[model samples]
Target: MTTSSDQQHREAALTDTVLRSFESCTDPRLKLVLQSLVQHLHDFIRDVRLTEDEWRTAIDFLTEAGHITDDKRQEFILLSDVLGASMQTIAVNNEAFKDATESTVWGPFFVDGSPEIPLGGDMTLGAAGEPCWVEGSITDTDGNPVPDALVEVWEADENGRYDVQYRDGRTAARAHLRTGDDGGYRFWAVTPTPYPIPHDGPVGALLAAVGRSPMRAAHLHFLVRAAGYRELVTHIFVEGDELLADDAVFGVKASLVKQFERARGATPDGRELDGRSWSRVRFDIVLAPHGS
Candidate 1:
């Protein structure tokens, strides 16, 4: 089936009219962004010939997503994680700098303003679980040290629940600390364990409809910031963890994986870890230089 010349001209006219309307804009950056979005969105609609029902369903999904968000969670980030677009965008924007660390998605659960903690301290705040240690450094892309870089971190508790998920029970796992003079930093926290994405929301419903799992493998989340360097949001996964390849949010990167080694010595305080045992881990982060 071939379209009549008039029909083709009408579609072309619509495309031109929409695109040209933005040409008079003085802001070059805004103009370029609007142009690209228009081009891709138009192409998508034409290529898929999306049905009215499909469009309506999309609107409903977005509406519900907004409705479900609170101070502690972001539904849109969850949506993007499932689609892999968040990680892709991060990768594209965070192309290697001389020695800077790459940025990944600041996943939905990040709650700003965590408590400040001392070096070698536990962000777990006396929570129950396997003892885990996370240590790392912040360096420029050139491998130069970035001293005093602020490393902010947050993660779920032992019961696979975030602070927000609990009702005034205990403190959230949020913590903030700066890198030492050698650009190295270490902290004690429970080894991360796999947890399910909130499955009672609209996104969960979508996942269920598609026969997908909501499980995110155990991993530590980081938000590293430095003077004259780009801020980074990423995760360090435990080696041999079962969900590495299938993170519910698809946030894992091959380069970000680290081994959580077992250590037999006494903990930092020179005391036995309840006479059970203690595990040690080291995760170093490298950052990109300024103005890259």
Candidate 2:
């Protein structure tokens, strides 16, 4: 008869056999990573006393997540975000740049080849929302200006939907701009609004199972890059957003929050905005040097 002690011995033998199999791996990093992964996975399984039925269910859930992922949507990234894995990784990799701009998760909605606009140009493209003017400067950690930095910006409309969410997958409310010689850049965009992540897939089911809301805070996304400086991916969240404390992806940082004030006349540079009122925000970004 197979006793409990016999089962424990068998399990230990199986783990040792599996670990030995990785000893022949040629890549040192790969070998180390695989060994750690195996040990942790086995430990977790033992700690939970996971049953065969539960393992099968987990496999099914991952399979469904894979089936729903495609070019337009990334279920795996969504999985990482909802589980806080993405933010945790960012935190680990960005620990050295505490004084510089904090990084955040790059959501799945970013599209390549957005139209480039001039300084003080408008990115709204007649999108449906209140007009807002964003102005900022790019500088190094020591306060030296970085000229001609490429700034890519994208955000959802007032309705909390990206252009990709539409049936035709048309692009809107997104643009690429460059900092001027003085490291200053400005653009017009719609005010951001809180929105739910796409919740019709396996990730949604997981969130529901844990009784968590799927709403992200009101914010605008940015990707900035300059020569000799580290690439920065982050966002400026609107101050006092209702979901700021409970962002679905845990992306909010205190330094990234900025106030959006009401302005009823022309823009900051005195360019008449067709007599429409607008919101204004200034968010200066500082980048760390490469290898810092």
Candidate 3:
């Protein structure tokens, strides 16, 4: 009979062998990463005494995730998000720096080449949701305006569905715009609403099995970029969202929460709402210098 000590010795020997196999890797970083991965992976396997059935189930789960992924949907990213790995990775890369805006998970729904809109223009493009005015300023750590910054925004509609979720290939509730000379930006958009992340696939099944909800808090997404500053990928969560404390992807930060005040009749830009109610919110962003 193999004693527990013998079993541990055998596992360590196997891990060392795998580590040595990467000794010839040409890149120092690659070598370091592979060795550490081997060490941790082996340790986890040993700690769990993972059964063959469990290992096969994991492999099958990953296979299904890859099968569901495509240009319009990214199951792997969804998997990462649900596991809290996405937030953990973001936290590791975005260190604290003098009041710079916090970063969060970049959801799988983002698409490139979003339509561009002028300041104060409407980004809704006919999506179904309550109208909202989003205004904010882009500034550096020293409080100076960062003019001409590109701000990309996207969000789900009242029904909690993104444009990409529909079959017709229509774009709505998303656009990109540049900041004004004074670093101010304003645009019309749909007010954010609470929604569940796509939960019909492997990630959803995992959440269900673990008794966790796949719901995210109401929020607006932003990807702000400017020369000489670190890119800001974040969200402004609705202040009173009940899910704020339990965001599926763990993306909410206290500083990013903001109130969405109700509006009626007239808009700041003098547009007529024709008696329809609306909301307005402000989100001033501060960017850290590239090296900071």
Candidate 4:
């Protein structure tokens, strides 16, 4: 025999019950955010009256996601990308200078302490798959060269696998190079090949249930940090990549696409012979002015 007043009080207790756990939070902003999140989540659950089976399915999916991750693969980040959450976060944080380089996905493959290497050195020393001479200049929007800018770059190997993915703990094909006097840097690596994201994880299961594919277009990832300029995290997308439109992470931007043209048969540019045909790519980075 539940009275009408008891039901009313119970309903009113919803907000109270949710806030009780957070009562010790001192930060007003954090408390506000947590409270709002609780309200929305509760409202959503009530609106849908989510079934126990559906909730169990979600838990199972997350569990599988955790099981698939080891040292190299980040199934959770892949999940965020496919669901557009990663892109949304990038968009929100990228509202600085309209004239500066656009920010792109940081991606999950970045490793700490890449081996320091000299300018114009080849990162692809062992196996030669494709010839690619990548040169880039970092500069301010007004066209002033940024010298000594630390340009950290990395990309998948010829087989579309990161060095860490196969090398375990040792430093593989990744390196960090500094810009020279001309504000230019160059490196030789394999021409990136499109590859599939790990499709055996929970994310892959979710995608399969909805009949989706897990693939990211071929691109080089860069993180540029200089003393006076805003730090930039972005990618240079190779033109004509098949996965541009259907990137699993939804990371493509019109501003980041660059052409990778086939180099002419043996010409002068101080480039030597590799059995594999070579490709040329030029990327110019526009950094934001210092303290803008």
> Could you say which candidate leads in lDDT?
3
| Model 2, CA-based lDDT | 0.90
- Ten-residue segment with the worst summed lDDT in candidate 1? 268-277
What's the lDDT for all of these models?
0.81, 0.90, 0.94, 0.80
Residues 168-271 of candidate 1: C-alpha lDDT, one tens digit per residue:
75676768898889998888888788899888888899999999999888878899877787778888887899898888877877777888887776776564
- Predicted candidate 2 versus true structure: per-residue lDDT over 62-111, tens digit per residue: 99999998887999999999999999998888766757999999998888
**Decreasing TM-score order of the candidates:** 3, 2, 1, 4
Q: Best candidate, TM-score-wise?
A: 3
RMSD after Cα superposition, model 4: 3.5
The order of the candidates by lDDT, greatest first, is: 3, 2, 1, 4
What residue pairs are clashing in model 4?
none
7-124 per-residue lDDT for model 4 (tens digits): 6567558867987889789998999899888888776755576689988998888888888877678878888888998889888876768569888887778887887888888766
- Candidate 4 wrong stretches, greater than 4 Å: 1-16, 167-170, 267-269, 289-292
- Candidate 2 TM-score versus the reference: 0.95
